[model samples]
Target: MRASLSIVSLLAGAVAAAPAPKIPFVTATDVIPAPAVNARQSASQACFVIGSETLPKEVSDVAAALASSVTCDKSATTIANVPDVTSGSTTFSSIDFSQSSQTALQFALSKFATANPLADTDLQTFQDMLDVYQATEAGIRSVGGSLAIKVPKFFLEMQVSRIQTAQGNPPTAAGLQVDHLRDKVLKNAPRESKDLLDQVTQLATVLS
Candidate 1:
């Protein structure tokens, strides 16, 4: 009985002393590639400007009317609703631009250009806003373009959040990308963009 008790105690000690199984360290690459991370960061900043400030209030109102003009299935519920990110679907056909919508969008773009002049100013905010606006205009002119314009998913996400916020609805997944972009911008983005980091960071708090 004594020997058996000693053997049992030794086994228990051995079990306790055994090393815990190693948990695989997940590298940043395992979750998101460096290029993708940079892209998302860029998209968030650009979309924040486009949705929150760049596009005139009338442009968004026009977009809402254009969305109403389209025929969409039950899944096409709201402007805030976007396609599944993991599905690898880039374009959403839920909102097709009518001729009227196209005309309105073009007019809005023209207005944006005329209103926001890039004078000799060192403010990075204005410069970044201009860059995003030009890119959006190019997207609008692309073949089979929609009023929303094709941009990175992160940008679309921020845009949707802005729309929802305007409608008094809570932003869906608001801080997910905004917070990530906030971190990356603070750490990696150029000094010029970083100077305008408050605009993006403020979204994280408001949207959250």
Candidate 2:
């Protein structure tokens, strides 16, 4: 009788120690979508009217002209609550502008190469542009911290310079303006470049 009692006690203890089954809660499917800039508006803003087939050897000029035309209007929405978006296991507070810029530059370079395949001179220009890009990236990385603003200005100026070089002319006054901004940002970054890029990328995503 004592052995049976002991066995009953052990079974009761084991049952008490067992974890309860998990219960799942149902969620509504009507999740709010992220704010976005209309594709038509974004494309219109980025559109360029070029006459030549080649990636205007003067890439800087082309880029500057393109930049000048961009107007962040009503259709251009910021991707607010971007922290809600997750990448793998992590949720980002802002967009990665530098990475996006790098991507854009690479795409631009590739497009330019495709457009100017027959122009042997443009090949050297492309090489020089890549060199400048490498130096600029290295410069920003070495400086660190708020010194990152230099990246955008440098990128903008490089875009202008490339177009100018392609057109057989030196970078214009506007390119110099971007260069000045770059110098100031490099000397005193008001905010970290990485942070700035994050914000910019988040905003740009609305364009997508």
Candidate 3:
């Protein structure tokens, strides 16, 4: 217990005062490689602070002291009702689920060109979307069944719209890093996922 407390005290100063992903978009593995499949899962399921990788070495050390008892969430239906951030729409009612999530996201981002960085209210809006993404990721993973793979598309689709949103305000260093991580996921996204994300007819702004 004393050892754990000491690690916590150390991290209080090690972690940055600014927002997360401050390191230009490197995932947890980049901060420090996971030892094995189960070890990686343990780190993944640990508390957010331990898993955040915001402080890299400091966080990795802290994670070693804690045991991950939490299980990965596999509830694929959890994201079904969440409103689309782009246009505030919901189009996932069909059986075939044919529409692609990557398509919606790409379309939205295409409208982006970097104007001004997000500010004040714009930051809040960005944070709201981020909260949803983080929450969804906590439970969803590549190891899950087919349903789990399909569930995250909605959130993925909204990101392109965010690029539209951020671009209108213009892309900041922070925003660009966010985009980088989003693309990494999209590129590595698991297969067999059905139709995901809401439909958008207009530009990203059309929905935002």
Candidate 4:
């Protein structure tokens, strides 16, 4: 009887020690979260910049133009409890945004990729989030080819700079204009740049 009790105790201990089931990813559909911005507006403007078949090789100058055009503006929306975004076992909060642009972007992508064979969750939302990821990756890769990568690449650096300055760590806010805010803000951006614009917009919700 003592041996049986000891075996039961061991099983009970093992059960107690097991890790809790991980939370599933959150979806835009499930909870849009608060502080959502006019990402589509930025996206539209970016698409115009991307319309040229061959982007100019001058990365810094062109990127400055691209970044300048995508001034994120806040839109009024009903505030909902900010849902903690997760993908598979990875929570959105777990991803690092403080690294180099490439490293940070890749890290974010990897977290989402690992979520494949996704747990029982809405696939559409995951795919949409993934599109946003790929868009940033595409824009980064496009630097040498077509898309002028430095633009998205700068977002990472900008976040770092923000951390150093006052915006804190995150790339979404249009930042205070010590002088005056620039015009040509995102309003009717094309579909192509939507994903990248979205990634930037999403960062503001959590990091800002």
Best by TM-score: 3
**In candidate 2, where is summed lDDT lowest over 10 consecutive residues?**
78-87
Cα-based TM-score, every candidate? 0.22, 0.24, 0.28, 0.21
User: lDDT at 74 for candidate 4?
Assistant: 23
The parts of candidate 4 lying over 4 Å away from their true place are 1-110, 113-119, 145-208
- What is the TM-score ranking, best to worst? 3, 2, 1, 4
Model 2 residue runs over 4 Å out of place are 1-68, 79-150, 172-208
Tens-place lDDT digits, model 3, residues 26-61: 766776756664444444554332223332342233
Q: For candidate 4, write residues 48-106 as lDDT tens digits.
A: 22322333344323333344322211231111211223233433223423333543334
How high is the CA lDDT of each candidate model?
0.36, 0.37, 0.36, 0.35
Runs in model 1 with CA error above 4 Å? 1-156, 171-192, 206-208
> In candidate 4, how many Å is residue 197 off?
30
Candidate 1 TM-score, true structure as reference: 0.22
**Which whole-number lDDT from 0 to 100 does residue 152 have in model 1?**
28
Put down candidate 1 lDDT per residue, 47-148, tens digits, no spaces: 211232333333333233323222223343223332111111221232222213433233222222211122222233322332333334322432223444
Candidate 4, number of clashes:
7
Q: Candidate 4 — worst ten consecutive residues by lDDT sum? A: 177-186
Report model 4's TM-score to 2 decimal places: 0.21
lDDT of 2 by residue, 17-106 (tens): 999899976579666678875433332233231122222224433333333332222332222211122222222112334434454333
